[model samples]
Target chain A: MAVLNMVSALNQAFGGEMERDPSVVVLGEDVGRDGGVFRVTEGLLDRFGADRVVDTPLAEMAIAGMAVGMALNGLRPVAEIQFMGFSYLTLSTMISHASRMRNRTRSGMHVPMVMRMPYGAGVKALEHHSESMEALFVQVPGLKVVVPSTPREAKGLLISSIRDPDPVVFLEPTRSYRLMKEEVEEESFTIPLGEARQVREGDDITVVGWGAMMPLIEKAVGSVGKKGIECDVLDLRTLSPMDSTAVLSSVRKTGRCVIVQEAPRNCGVAAELIARINEGALLSLEAPVERVTAPDIVVPLPQGEGHYYITPGRIENAIERVANF
Target chain B: MLIDDYDPLKKRMLQVLDQEGKVVNPSLEPVLDPDVLMRAYRTMVLARQIDDKAVILQRQGRLGAYPPNRGQEAASLGPAMAIGKDDWLVWAFRELAGLLWKGLDPLRLYLYWMGNEEGSHYPPGLKVLPAVIPVGSQLPIAVGMAYASMIRREGTVTLSYCGDGATSAGDFHEALNSAGTFRTPNVFVIQNNQWAISMPRNRQTAAPTLAQKAVAYGFPGIMVDGNDVLAMYMATQEAVGRARRGEGPTLIEAYTYRMGNHTTSDDAKKYRLEEELKEWEKRDPLVRLKAYLMNRGMLDERQEETILGEAKEETERIVVEAERFPRPTVDDVFKHTYAQMPRTLTEQLERCRRLEGGGR
Candidate 1:
């Protein structure tokens, strides 16, 4: 086991996959010499050379479309959109083509590619840089949206995402990239998408989080656990093909639920999760599922993000209210 | 052969053969073996016939909405012929001529307009992507494929076809920029058909020529008389060769005109002038190519009739085959999102199946 953060774990996953599959190629702005904006792809250029490790221009749409084409023509390309904020231009290609390639073609042709971008707020980033648009892509036809909560899960899920015979929008948590280190497996392993990782077990309530919100949910769990509140903390590894069984089973056992998200509250992934829970385990629930999410407004500047970002206190409070209800 | 100092704003349109059925620049003309020349002419004839048949199909309510590629046969087929079998065709809307030239089953294209997902399906190793509906979107994907080809040392060139209007898209700029910056194997042939739906070419860009925009991306951007099949073919061949030798990408703006409405849904007569349409009709791709071939003694009246007859026969047969394709199931909509249908889709598929009277 190696103590690694999300960035290193992601880099290791890239290296491991590239080594395992020659068809795997990495492309993005500064992915080669600059080693990515946060060094997430550090030292890959030297190891793999210019061919495998491509440094693309400031073109997110090209990054995505090009990756899809590469996937179309045998190469399994891993494209990096420097930040999730600039992903709007690329979304047309992703949703219209990459996401719909498999279903639209229906002739066994699929885009076996991964578009990796660091998402979310709390690191005091710029306007577009702090967005969490997981909910937007979930509705896309053939896309699998994966967001890892920790370094270990990041490595495992990425391996699986790369290997999966479909397009995946792998959202990396910018705040969590170097936030902390965890014991990650040295050998490459794919933690299949659509499977939930229940970080902590409890019988009273079910707590869910993903990406940057996982740490907040974990902190809230810690805060509540100290006061004798037992809960099952589940890290939703993949949001598209959600781990409904894990969520439904946990909600059934716990009888109370709370979903945390960095995106807007109106139509967040939390809302979808709540809908699924209501449909699948409504009778088993003792109380209504509470959602701790950002307001349905555009993300504020660094000055006001501290108030808008989901905190452990809010999650803890929501848990207590739901647990007591 | 790479135009090292191409000025995008210049009005330097490359024309190998003039409309008078004469080779204006014999030195620039490719060594057109009789067989290759005949095939090129045949493909153009087929393209026009297929497009004309589609317009009829649309009127008869047999086909869905179609953007007819009536006057732009040369622009597509020329470049489509230039690239090798290994290269990929990242096509935009209205590129049936190119797809057919590249061996995409003509019936599948007709099936595509008939609202079948299977229409986008190409045989393995065909390397032709599904027709991108969104304008200018496929350009970047072509760059990416070329990027992959270069990285793998596969020596494959990617020829992306788009209309004159696609040049204004940010992805178009991005695609050109990356290909220029990376020195990847890419050739973008913008069919400057003078109109992007209702918006004319002048409204699309302030730049004098669409090809000049390629200069901004640090690459050669050449404007070719798109109606001149030989000129377009020569330009694309040069571009393909440059890309294979790791020289760089080229943007060939095929200056042509769209002789039809944007689609079955659009009323072109309401916006476009009849005079402009008539003037462009004189430089028709098929007529020019046929006349040039006849003057060169490669095609006579009998051969011309045979070609037209064959294209008509093929178009009629493809329409019959296209209509025979079974209707797609509602269940197919839920599948193909992932490798195996995920748990959510699995449940949804079951629901849809039940709705379709599966009973279980």
Candidate 2:
């Protein structure tokens, strides 16, 4: 084990996978020589050469569409979309082709590729930079949406995603890239998708979140714990094909739930979780579930980011309210 | 090189056989085997018959809305004939002739129009992608496939088809630009069939010729008389040879006409003139090819009758077989979504099965 940041851990994942599998190729704008916009693919071009680590033309749709073709032709391609905001350009190909290739051809073809992008607010970046749009991808069928909160999860889940036989949208948390350090295993390891990890076990209430919101949820749990309010915190690693069993069981045990998200509130993943809880664990609930999310509005520019960004204070308040109720 | 000689910017169009079915460019004419020529002619005829029957089927409520490939048979089949067996063919929805030449069973095409998913399950080693409905979306996919071939040193080229209107889409430019940058073995054939639904070619772009667009992408582009099968075949052959030799991509603009409605659901008479249809009818690709074959004594009137009669019988058999194909089951809907269906999907499928009265 070695202590590393999310960027280093992910770079190790890419390097390890490419070295192990000759069929794995990396392609995106500036992914070759420049490593990546975030340097997550640093040193791959030199290590794997240009054929395996390609710097594509500055067209998101082509990058994604070409990745689909490459995947169909027996290449495991991991394409980066620079940023989540720029990823919408690839939705045309993702929704029309990559998401349906296997179903349309009835198993004759499948897109075994990954589209990686840095998402979420609180980075105070420029317009179209910090976007938490995981909900958009989660709603798309035939796609696996994985968001890794820590260095270990990022490396493990990404390797598993690259190996899976379906297209995966791996959204990296921009705020968590270099925020904290952790001791991550250097060797290849896979955290199976559709399984949630229980960060803290408690009986007062169940606090559910993922991606960039995990840090805030932990902070809220810490502050509420000081107030003698112990909470159960669950980090949902994969959004699509969600680990509903974990969430339902946790809610049933605690008899109270509070879902938090960095994305806007309307029709978000939190809403889906609440509906599922109502379906399976409603009779066990002691109070109505509470949701803490950013309002349904455009993520503001740098100066106004703090106003729209979800804070730990808001999460703590929601957690305490559910705990008391 | 045919591509360099008939540059679109120079307003030069390549033509081996003129409108009268006479060899106008003997030096550029390809010396194809007699059997190959006969097969090419037969495939074009069969494609036309299928189009006609498909239109009637749609009208008779036996098939869904179908697109007609009336006058653009040579524009599609000629390039298909030039493609090697290992080459990939990525087609837009209206390339019936090319699909037939690539060995796709007519029953599958009929089943596709009859609203069945199994129709897209092409046999192994056919090297053809299912029809892409969105305009210009398949271009980038072809480029990617070609790129993969180049990386793997597969020594295989990719041929893709689109109509004139697809040139207006951003994906067209992006795909060609990438193909040129990477110099992948790709041949982009644009069947400039004169109409995109009701919109005419003149309204689609301000460029004098659609083929000139390839110039901006740093590749050779040429226009051909799409009604002349010899020119289409010759141009594509040269382009395919260039790609195989690692000389990069080539763009061929097949200047043809849509001799039928855009689809069975469309009515060309609503916006087009009768005189225009008459002018195009005289230049039908099948007629031109047949006249040339007859002049060379390779095909006779009686032989032509036999070919048509055989195609009609085969098409009837294909229709019966396609209609009798098994319907999709509930499991099929959930099976291929993922390599292994998730528990949620399996549960949903089970619920659907129970709802359908197959309780277990």
Listed per model, the TM-scores of chain A against the true chain A are: 0.98, 0.99
- Top lDDT hit: 2
Clashes of each: 3, 0
lDDT of each: 0.88, 0.92
- What's candidate 1's i-RMS value? 1.3
- Fill in the DockQ of model 1: 0.75
- Worst 10-residue stretch by lDDT in candidate 1 chain B? B1-10
Tens-place lDDT per residue, model 2, A1-325, is 8999999999999999999999999999999999998999999999999999999999998999899989987799999999999999899899989989999888888899999999988988889998999999999889999999999999999999999999999999999999989999989889898889999999989999999899989888899999998898999999988998999999999999999989999999999999999989999999999999999999999999888998899999998898888
Please give me the DockQ of candidate 2 compared with the native complex.
Answer: 0.80
lDDT by residue (B275-316, candidate 1, tens digit) is 999999999988899888999899999988998999999999
Give the lDDT of residue B157 in candidate 1. 93
- Quick one: best DockQ, which candidate? 2
